[model samples]
Target: MRRLVGVLVAVGLALGVVSAGPASAAIDSSGSAVILPPDQDPFYVPPADYGSRPNGTVLRSREITALAYVMPIPVHAYQVLYKSVDGHGAPVAEAATVLVPYTSWTGPGTRPLVSYQIADDSLSTRCQPSYTLRVGIGSPTGVGSYEVSMSYQALLRGYAIVYADYEGPHSQFAAGPQAAHGVLDGMRAVLHHAPAGLDPNTKITLWGYSGGGLATTWAAEQQGSYAPELNVVGAAAGGVPAELGAMLRHNNGNLGAGLALLGVIGLARAYPESGVYGILNDRGRALFATNEDACTLDVAVLHPFDRIENYTTIADPIDSPQARFLIDTNNPGQATPRMPYYNYEALQDEFVPAALADGLLKDYCADGGTVKKVRIPFSGHITGEVQGGPGALQFLADRVAGKPVTSDC
Candidate 1:
């Protein structure tokens, strides 16, 4: 609790979100006391039984008016709180926003489903896409997550959308398996949801970039073995940090360090056995504690040239066995996906090194997987999202139509 408070206070101070609220400073939510200042609204906490339910079991649901940024489409939306598993296979409740266009599918057969995972790279639940998609206000703390708006294009393409919080109730950020489960199970929830009118065997495609890409890739890998019943057509992931260890090495002392550290902190949240706090030295521990509740921009802009070594007690902090295992365990591309994949990366990506995408593609192809690799020129990490999103959408359209995908590798 002290650690949680310290993180909230430090982030509140740094983000200027410290203010008194109508309720008490601390309120119990799901057995944890969350410090809610006036500037920061508390995110939804699922009930204890949520986790005990079967994966994809919808506990409760309500129809919501989903407003897209520039699109005037009357999107039929529903908020679903469904059962999901964690990295450890423990039960958890996760929420997803399902948006169905009023227009019918112009293509053949059933309407295609796009499980869009936004790049919700934050430890704060306020930044989750489910919260940001509503009409009321943006992220409660004003972190400004606009990725949900990007889903507008998918809606424009007439694809039924299932956007999961992905990070689960705790905002497990970069936790691979946890995010993967939320995504796959969220798809399950959307498919089984009676109001959505989706075919139980609908063609599904996973799409995301950066953090979202990590979740997409992980889900693609886990689908064949984890949830084999879901008919996933394909997956498109761009600017994926396939290996967190490689990401740490690439971002250390660079502009991406702040956002990169969030992944480290996230890994700690995901894998308690990894000893994130145990590995950190005094300065590292303090830094980690201060940024506990920090969002993507808060971390990225605040400490641009930070180095991970400065926070650790040992000479090679990430080189330890525990750290290595944690990173490797979360990294994707080891498990060959059962479907064709579209992966892209910018050659000049400043945040995620292109080599990460290249390595994943190479590994997937070597395992007899059909993969299409695209290298976006004259783009950096952030620009790659804009360049890659449309192509991924097109790929999903083709895949959903049962088009044969020829490998670009």
Candidate 2:
């Protein structure tokens, strides 16, 4: 296994794919001069027998300082590589960052676990929270760094938080099953880690907004079947893109077209049988190659108000049979969540229509799931996170406190 990792590292360096930084470079609260990204980092590579390990089994772990943007957060932090499954149920190693606050848990039960999913709406591994939350490695200007503030808030409440790279190793953004498995397995890994001093039976609440919301909700729905042993009590998801097809249709040629395209690229990665590359025209191929490792802001700035037809050979690639199948397979709401769910949506959201989330909650409710729905009026996609966070946090807090919740279904 060590030999395999060394060979991989050598190949990466030879190809100029990995960071060629000094090994002795000091890693501190203030950003380091050079830090290896996940693709090049040795810790991310699992052993040859990783697939033989049980799901959520920790493959490797290292202590690191957690950071909210550039400032070092005073907490016990560790990045863990664990075994998980992809969208296809194949074993895959995933990464997650676990944070335990200095202050002890004074809450009713064992310190609650908040599996905080950051909205990594990018095609790049650099956007994963496991990397971005590390000191001196994360981009201070990136969205991942900004979202770390929410994790900081949870840490302040003495809640142990696990920020999973729920998008998986490939950064398979918007791939529902993969994301769900990653989040659940990450929670499993953290709960089992001895150094964190967490009870194995700790109550857990899932929380996220936007892309993160999609992952949280998926985990909520899949936990009943995929990770039934998890002690998840509730989930709070804000600004969810519940239906991917609807999102792509809503954003086509609009300001969010680039973001939608990124989703298409991600889906292609997750389900290669979708034949996205085969249908792409020259322009589409070029765009795919260029944005293959791009972050959310990069796509948002580069391809806003762009049309899908401009890149594809077919007039409506999104409506094609392959795309439709992928969409139906990935979309949430088909299954009922075993635990209570809180969903908040921006009524004026442009990227994801409010009606899609409404329909999703309606279905979940009709299927006998407990759901609380919040509609934020006069707020769009970006502002809805700020407006909806407090209520979501309170919902999580109530669940952690063992407060009885009435279904707003």
lDDT of each: 0.78, 0.84
As a TM-score, model 1 comes out at 0.87
Please provide, for model 2 over 230-305, each residue's C-alpha lDDT reduced to its tens digit, 9 standing for 90 to 100.
9999999998898888899899989898788889989998999888888999999998887787777666655667
**Tens-digit per-residue lDDT, 20-81, candidate 1:** 22223332222244434223532345676666677988877878665443232387888888
The stretch of ten residues in a row with the least summed lDDT in candidate 2 is 17-26
Q: How many clashing residue pairs, candidate 1?
A: 1
Off by over 4 Å in 1: 1-48, 69-73, 135-137, 140-145
Q: Say which candidate scores most in TM-score.
A: 2
For candidate 1, give the lDDT of residue 235: 96
